[model samples]
Target chain A: MIKIKSIRNKILVWVFLLFLAIWGGISYATFYQSSHEVEELFDSELAQAAGVLSQFASVVDLSHPMIDPKLQKDIYGHRYEKKIAFQILGNNTLNLHSANAPTTIMSNTAGFSDQIINNNLWRVFRLNVKEQNQVIITAERYDVRNELIHEITKNSLYPLTLMIPILLFIIWVGIDRGLSPIRKLAKQIRQRSPEKLEPISVNFEIPNEITPLFSALNSLFGKLKAAFERERRFTSDASHELQTPLASIKTQAQVAIRSDNKDTQRHALEKVVEGIDRATHMVQQLLSLARLEPLTSLDETSDLNLYSLTQTVISELDAESHKKNIELSLDGEESIQIKGNQPAIEILISNLLSNAIRYSPEQGHVDVAIKKVSDRVQLSVSDSGPGIPEQDIKRVFERFYRGQNCQHILGSGLGLSITQRIAELHNATINLSHNPDNGLVVTVEFVAKN
Target chain B: MRILLVEDDPILGDGIKSGLLQDHYNVDWLTDGGQASQALQTDSYDLLLLDLNLPVKSGIDILKQIRKTGNALPVLILTARDATEDRIKGLDMGADDYLTKPFDLDELLARIRALLRRSKGRTTPTLTHGELELNPVEHTLSMSNKPVDLSPVEFQLLQLLLENRGRVFPKKQMEDNIYGWNKEVDSNAIEVHIHHLRKKLGNDLIRTIRGVGYVIDKQ
Candidate 1:
């Protein structure tokens, strides 16, 4: 249950444990087998010893080895015979015995029995010979058989216990060798500079288990390179666009400084102010567009009425439309709900409305419509102005793209691009279609919240 | 000097035109490349101030056309594009010089003067004839060691005839150069300026070619 954090340690611990378990099983089997063989061999030896003694008693013909069963009590009275290692007893009497055996009979009747004689346990066996009317009592030390079994089992187990530490060291070294590729990869990554976005080549001698890891990391590096490239291009293009108006401002300010007449100086100063305003607006638009790039989704949103939002944006641009005498009118549904962030959606609506107003000619008409088509809420703004040409429409959403026809119009050329981005933030679809009646109709569709 | 200014930006073009007028040079400003190209072809100008970015046509194409036709009209590229490659392209495409936008008015005037001087195959900034010295940058005329005070038109008339010493200019052409297309001029305006120049300097400096035009002899 120890939570090993390192792969090397985990492998080492697991292999060591498996080795110990297998060794323990094999040692147990060996000991069991050895013990079984020893038991059979010892029992047979005891029976053979008794057989030898029985033949010896048949031939000796000494004082009738055991003549009376009543004489065993008299034999127990002889304490001096306790030191004998063998004994012969018959008919409940012991007539002859070795010094290690008890003077009394071990058993009155037995084939094989375990007895304590002179404070030592023995394996005793008896054979009764009816032809001689005698019993051959043979006993061997029981501890001797156990001691032999113990010796064989010890030989089998001693080597396994002594080898545990050395085997652990071998396993540890093996795991370290196996994980060297990972260590090499870590060192390579650590030595790399932060700006090194180039993809790492996977043509190293890495293991098969982590080759996928290298491929995934390389793909990430590729993505990072592309992102950095995109960011560089964006900064370059943004600076280029910003410099144009700044150049205008600088030129006009210098002109004002050198102008001898009040009228020309006033006019130059006024233009300088206009250029400042235009630059400021362009900067705000640029920041807004830049901010929208990293937002994958909106965090705070509500079910907004698309009709009401359009009305609000129209009212905000009332003065601008009035300057051009554009007849701005709203149509279709009074209320249609869409899920979106409020400020983002407001910017979207405002950009569209202002773009329409900016492009519309004096006394021209602009139509703002809100419609709920199935599950989608659609907002369309149409203007009676010079619509985009067939070729320019595709690039209309590119930053700082002012159409050839739109060059005469006063614009920073970031309006539609911002509008498109805001619409994208809301997961809405924006479309631009050329009107046959010499105008443009822009439609934005959002999924209905209801 | 009469300068043809081609710029798409309204305020910048107006400021440039106004600034040029204050320097006593006749200036005609057009807002786009197409109009400027047509003017370059049909009209005469001392120099062309061209903007690179325009609606109908780019100034590069106009420059290519002028160079293709072997016209040595001095063209100065005035643009908002400050990149090294853009400037190189503008110059290599037969532009006399290049100037990025938001430029100093003084530097613009100095470059224009230099370009005009170089176009006339002159290295120095001043036009000289015998004992008369005309400084275009300072807008001054001197007889021997004394500076002469002359009106703007008289100064222009003297400068035009002096720059092209042997060539004779008709009354209409002189009038056109004295006053750009933006202005209305009296029919005898050039004669009045010539008479004023004669009175201020000497009658022998500018000659009347007996109903042909005015000319300054090569001294």
Candidate 2:
């Protein structure tokens, strides 16, 4: 199932093929030059042999009946040596000939010529010795010169043929040694467990080419470790928050069961119901916060009217505001549009509005506005309540961080956290500030779609 | 026994206070750290039930401050943090006990009882002076195996004096121990409670040191 093209295999194949091509070219050139030099050397030897024969004719008595020269075997010559024959000619007569020499002249008046003698092609070199008034013709078979060139060519190619396999082996080993770091890195990764998100150690030496890869992998591990730690902390805090409410409910129910008087029992039952309601609200908020945390993509978004969304949230929270006798109103641009997920945006606005209403004092006023400012749509909710303290303003977006001034309020402290998460999902920015008049003002700015 | 319950969660604090009241323990509950710190400095309590998380000041800081003042008040930490490190930190900071939230009502009561017993330098849950035995859990008193009925105030007064048999308790201290901060006590409240205890348990069982206070001689 592994479909990777290995770097080691690629390197081995390419380098071997290149080495073969270069070696083949050098061998061919060596064979060709040796063949050419051998041919020229044998040709020159033929010419010099003709001149020596002419001098031998002068020393011998040519006027006496021309005696046929006996064939002689040279003890120092190789077994495949070609026969060299020469004839001395005076007044158009064959004066001397070896045992294998042709009776007919090989070539007439030639410096060097090719001819057939005794059904074999010969390389004939003729010299006219004017001092002795004789012509010397020295001839060697063409097959003999060709055999010499072939032997030289074969000898020159022998070393290259032996060196090719050794060169291939060396190339393979060199490539493997060069690419060992990558293999080691792959093995190191394969040996790790899924839960082991610790950074890979850089203790051993590595090549410069693969150092960046290691650094990137280590950084990725660091990020994954941090993400897991955050998740763990969130789960622990959530369970802790849930346990408190459940403890309250259990204690209240116990109180109800232990009471002998009806009034005390009824009061205890009321508290149990209240505890359940608070726990349910906290659970719902926790679920909303969990859902909002992973909404990183905006694929399910559409053009939403901020003004209408603000009005809908305000209307939904009207009863809550009325219970506290707080005045709630929505105003500003009528139809400012931004692209966002409707439910996410609704949650974002509802959290802000509910938080404002929950913290606002009796008879306090809450104002909501949606306005188009430049290229953005700004949705702001201002409440007349005690705002967060200066030190706590930065941590309001953290889950379950209730402000010092508003701890008595019935809240799970996840409202602003959820709001911040949803805003980030829709590529929006949220800001919390103290209202100059009183209370806190929360503003969410979304980039305009159009 | 008088107990100071410092918790930030209103409903849980109320539930614990009501539960403790049903057992006839004088409980003064404070919802924030600032007031709880102030109360601990100005008032006296047999034991302290401290919650680690609070609004203005954290419970740990109050515990630290209490310890810093060299007050060896028995502190039971009631927290939603069940981590081992948090427990260790609380105990290392001079807390006498640690309890995580969603705790059993019986367990909380037993821990409070144990803390009170430990603070009074007693190993048993029942207080005894000679033949009179006061069982706090069962809310019963017996002299030589015969049951005796006493009102809640008389029972608390007898339990306090019997727990510290050799030591004398000033009248004001006894009154504060029997009543919470919000309860308004008449000037003769302690005297009436002491008279009722003497009537139920016998005159020699309760002693009045005139200018000092009341004390039961160790048997």
Fnat of candidates, each listed: 0.53, 0.61
lDDT tens digits, residues A235-289, model 2?
8888878888898999888988888979878888888998899999999999998
lDDT of 2 by residue, B76-131 (tens): 99889778888898999999998888888888998888888888878988876667
Give the per-residue Cα lDDT of candidate 2 at B21. Answer: 93
> Runs in model 1 with CA error above 4 Å?
A1-5, A34-199, A205-208, A211-215, B1-7, B24-103, B107-130, B152-219
Q: Candidate 1 falls in which docking quality class?
A: acceptable
Q: Pick the candidate with the highest DockQ.
A: 2
Docking class of 2: medium
lDDT, model 2: 0.84
Where's the lowest-lDDT run of ten residues in candidate 1 chain B? B9-18
Best by lDDT: 2
Ten contiguous residues with the weakest lDDT in model 2 chain B: B197-206
- Assess the local accuracy of residue A351 in candidate 1 as a C-alpha lDDT between 0 and 100: 85
